[model samples]
Target: MDPARASIDLATKIANAVSTVSAQPWEILTERNPDGGRTFEAADIARLQQIRSEYATLSMRGNVFCFREAFDYPGFSINEYCRDLHPNPVGESINLKIQAWSESHGIWIPGISEHCHDIAAFLHPEAGEDRFIAVAKCLSVDWYLNDSIGREWAPTMSPAGQANAMALREHIVEISRAMKVAPDAPLIDKACVEMLLEMQALSGHPTWFSRFLEMWIGHVQRSCGNINAENLGQVPDVFTYLQNSPHQSGLYYTLAHFEFSRDEYLDWSTLTEYCLASDVRNLCWLCALIGGLSNDLISFEKEFVTHQSQSNFVVVLMLNYPALTLGEVVEAIMMILRDLMEHFVTLSGALKNRCAGRHGTPAFRATGIFVQAVEWGIMTTWVWQTRSQRYQHARSIFRETQQG
Candidate 1:
């Protein structure tokens, strides 16, 4: 009857359920891209070297964590579909700026700079030169603003911080209006404003643009609300914690980024209707849940060591179930992740079957691409977390427990 034993028992049940599901979806989803080949120009390689040099210099100046050599998570490995999608010179340069800005603003996480390049390049691999550059800029700005400012700052904002946050929110609203009304309008020299301008020029659908803005605004509002919720001091249960975790994970923004790819292939109405479909919506949420939970698992040690354990999923579980040891909780989380992955695989197949009738239609194509995007999101997140220096210290515990 002990809580820890009960959790282990539940995890056993989930694992048994997982054993019956076909893992073909996992194989299909994680398969490498057939066109993953690339031939970078000499200039591209040189630019990458320069970015590496800059990162090395930055690393030297601080006590940065070293990247982990490996993480042992069974059945979850790096998704190589975007392995060749390294950032171009423009993206690399903007990522440097993003790192500098975050450090200046006191929001820099040691390895976050690495994300700017990989995520942007992965999400926009097929984009043309201009659109890819625009996407890189927007993604860089969004990363810092949403993760650094919205997540890190808003939760603990003092009155002055709140004032500054308010100013930033208003500025975003102003830029959104400008983007809508005068797509060619000139903005200030700020990176954030320039990103808005770039998005305005490239946004394939007005609905996508509006929805992205709405999500951004909602992030700000929800984050600000946390400041009054005593910085998420305690939650009644995992369900309550999960309600907010997905948003904070920034997975929705990633979904919006995926929409950029759909712009070229699907009409606005089709895209809109597809996004509204129950299966599509469920897939998106599952992506969020998987990504967020995996993040909490990987980052638990770092957060705990840094005293930022208040809002983490592991911390929430620890608070609720005092009888559970850290290892037990981690094991339970792994089991839950497996269950979620099985469910995603099942739903993915069902959705594909539904689209089978319209094989060559835009809806069908969109469905294929969307499912692939979700798979990429989940796997890429795991890959990044395991390889990133941000969570390097957790690797020791992960290996000791052997439950990652």
Candidate 2:
């Protein structure tokens, strides 16, 4: 669901919860708590809600990062995202704010009492579909991540809940695979297409599956998504799904985790999350290779993730500076080609060993997400680099090029 509708629904749900309990006069507990300086005036709430709305509409950083992370898809980095989102001055720090927010609201969560709070706690009872979709969107997004603020969020689940979770996971996988096999649109009646073949089985009412499927596929094709490369059918609706897809893939986490702690590589053991993402990065590259697309960016990014480059990066200058002598191109080309070949070998081994067996096609299917995130980063750097040799000049040239 979009953000404004989602927020409205969330507000309603919280309000409803309050109203419901207040029917018997639910008490608003007045504990001796310190006031948080981050005041939420009516204006603040309006701005915040609008911010949420824009996130939904634009499929901004949160939507991209969260969604990509959820399905083991390759993802975008929030550090880089912060620089792009432009939501706050000085590129706001999410973890810092989360830490502050957590400290202030930690007590509000039910732990000692055994009844942890949910969004519904503060929501109105009469939540609308859109608002619930918004709140549920966050929950669903967060549900994919095992923790938020480094605290576990696996709310106590009854046997049924566990079953449902497993079932939904399987359902999504199956549906995604079926969609993969679907022929190019216009081959059959467009109305027969199901956005999610698995979920379609459950849409009992007059199904919107056809519309969803048609739009989603069209969206991917138009967006140059590597996921549907085999089909390349046009559908405009799929863009909607990008809003809630996981955001960070291995690159994002690697960069962000490193940002939060420079010793991320040394502490790689602690990087338990985004394991699938690490695998997905390689998988995405594999998909592009599988399709035999000779795009330099994908080929290079896959290589970077596989092995460290040993060659000097000045080779980039040779390619663009055509006025340079052949000696320069040859010398640099020799170095660049060697690195490329080595990277390719490393990539093949990485994917085949680290992912080819356990991760295979499903990971490949999620490549669209991986490509999307990388494209965003790539396009950003691409535009910036053309403007000036700002951040990536002295860097391996491949550092930004590798992921972009």
Candidate 3:
């Protein structure tokens, strides 16, 4: 009757339930084409390289503008943010992986290197240059802080590193509050602070920006805790794992970024009620689960081999269903993903029907746009996962780590 034992029992029950369901091969449910169904054309190779170069330039600018003096680690350089922080035995940079994935998926835009711009332009072609640049910077800093810095340093963080992270958390809260009041205020020395100000200035609704900041804060906090749990070798039960996976998956920020990108269509004052409504929350949560679970499914082998499975759903399932093979657990996850997608489609239709009479209103239009963005995100993520070298090289990296 101890707490850990109870969790294990609950997880076993859940895993048994999952094993009862038959899973089909994963297929795309949304009709929307990823990158407009464009494959990498031979003639486009040069242009794609040029686009990657531009993003590298932007990344360098981000490192200098945002991270230069942000963390107090000895010998810390902002240049580190510009490099691939993820373990890569192939020596390919993160930017290179992004470029390759984007190009092959045909998501590559000639002038727009950032995915935010692609979503924004898809929703509103009239979205201007300044807004594009601002969103790009927002994404850059978000990646630098969470993916690059947090992933690289959190696991083995010394007392000094923990202090640095805590300081950043405090600074982010202060700046988020300050930006809500004076969005155009002078830039703070911190990269995240400046990006928030830009996003707030361009955001369609005050509440949306506030919600976005809140989600980001939660993500940072949850990521730290999850990493600590992993360090301690504590495997959470299925329910607890589900509760935390979505936040750590970074899908909350993805949803927020989608909203931020289509700011011109949103009228937060009119949409505020809907934003708080359960239907809308359900839509967002479903999107996050789909994304988070798909990531866990694809990265399962990597994490399992690396012994970093403490935070992975697949790992939790394996622990509960000790007799189940990895292949069986994967199929179970796929089944769960398919069910979530079906639910999303049904709920999205209902939500759209609820707004049928107000088609011309900002709220109605925004709802439609938001639903489309969610569909796009889901399809794009699945397609990218299938083709991305980022997830494909995990075994090679693990082997190299062992050899070293």
Candidate 4:
């Protein structure tokens, strides 16, 4: 076989295995996994570990692919998981709060209130119940307020709306300043304000949570620019979109929150090593690239229907590569996702190894946790978008094909 063909073949296999393995929780297979305290069947654990080890090897060789044409949209069922592992009252309360908050704010987020438990389980399976519930609530509030309300409620077409949005950005700046002295400081929505306060209370470093708010504000400001472009009937070019992608995807806040939310409080040095390290920053960018592309590919149909595909990568590809049909553009994007995934996996492994070597050091452990959290973020975001009804509303050829 030709070497290039050989790589493609190996890449194809790896991609297929990843889709299958990732949809199922690895926590079921191992009690020792980083995911919060969820139980998995012993048999499944053995198989998943084998696949994970294989993926690590193939990824190192640069022969692994992340997704392919034969992909199935495997949506996770909140009801099923809840049935499997009954959540306590706190988990139940948070779920209700998420839904109520979303509904009151004119946002539509399917399964989030119910899915919060599963998300908490999937992301922090080894965590205690209290820790898991707090994390779940934080994630729910973040997604609801940041993605849903921020996108839906903002005025995208008028000067006044834009001005109003800017005013909100100023409030975020104030909120960040207040978190150090008064985490419960006043804000626009009491629920969101309370949610941030709760997250701050739970976090090892409340300052990190404040920083997350600042990053979120930055993303909101940049998003206003994108919406303004759309209002002017201008689509951002591929280069411009890439430049704005990290903030647009809310990567900074998510990464910052993960750094602070750990059960173990990281010291200043470890926090610096994880947050400011060049390699770690690069890894985050790569993860954002994967996440942005995956989101574009998954949500392309809805976005296109809503006339929001102007900034979408798939649309960008179609515009750039006119000879390619939409189907071809989708496939090309998948290949790009795979290529990026390979890079992400390789970098993550390198970071893990570097940290692992410093066994007894706090900075080393913090670095290790950061890499693991990034991996989880990349994979979980993929899985969530795949299953999310929020992005599944628009009917398109791509949606039909995925279903078929």
- The best candidate by lDDT is 1
lDDT of 3 at 244: 60
Tens-digit lDDT string for candidate 4 (131-211): 555565555545554443344345333567656655755565455446433445433344455556676677776467655
Clash list (residue pairs), candidate 3: none
lDDT of 2 by residue, 110-175 (tens): 221111112221121233333222222222222222221111111234446544444533443344
Residue-wise lDDT of candidate 3 within 346-368, one digit each (tens)?
78778777677677886777777
Sort by TM-score, best first: what order?
Answer: 1, 4, 3, 2
Best by TM-score: 1
Q: What lDDT would each prediction earn against the true structure?
A: 0.54, 0.27, 0.51, 0.52
Q: What is the lDDT of candidate 4?
A: 0.52
Shift of residue 139 alpha carbon in model 4, Å = 3.7
Instruction: Name the regions of candidate 1 deviating beyond 4 angstroms.
Output: 1-4, 9-116, 146-189, 223-236, 262-276, 353-357, 400-404
TM-scores, all candidates, are 0.66, 0.19, 0.59, 0.62
Tell me the spans in candidate 2 whose CA falls farther than 4 Å from its real position: 1-276, 286-341, 347-404
TM-score of 2: 0.19
Clashes of each: 0, 37, 0, 11
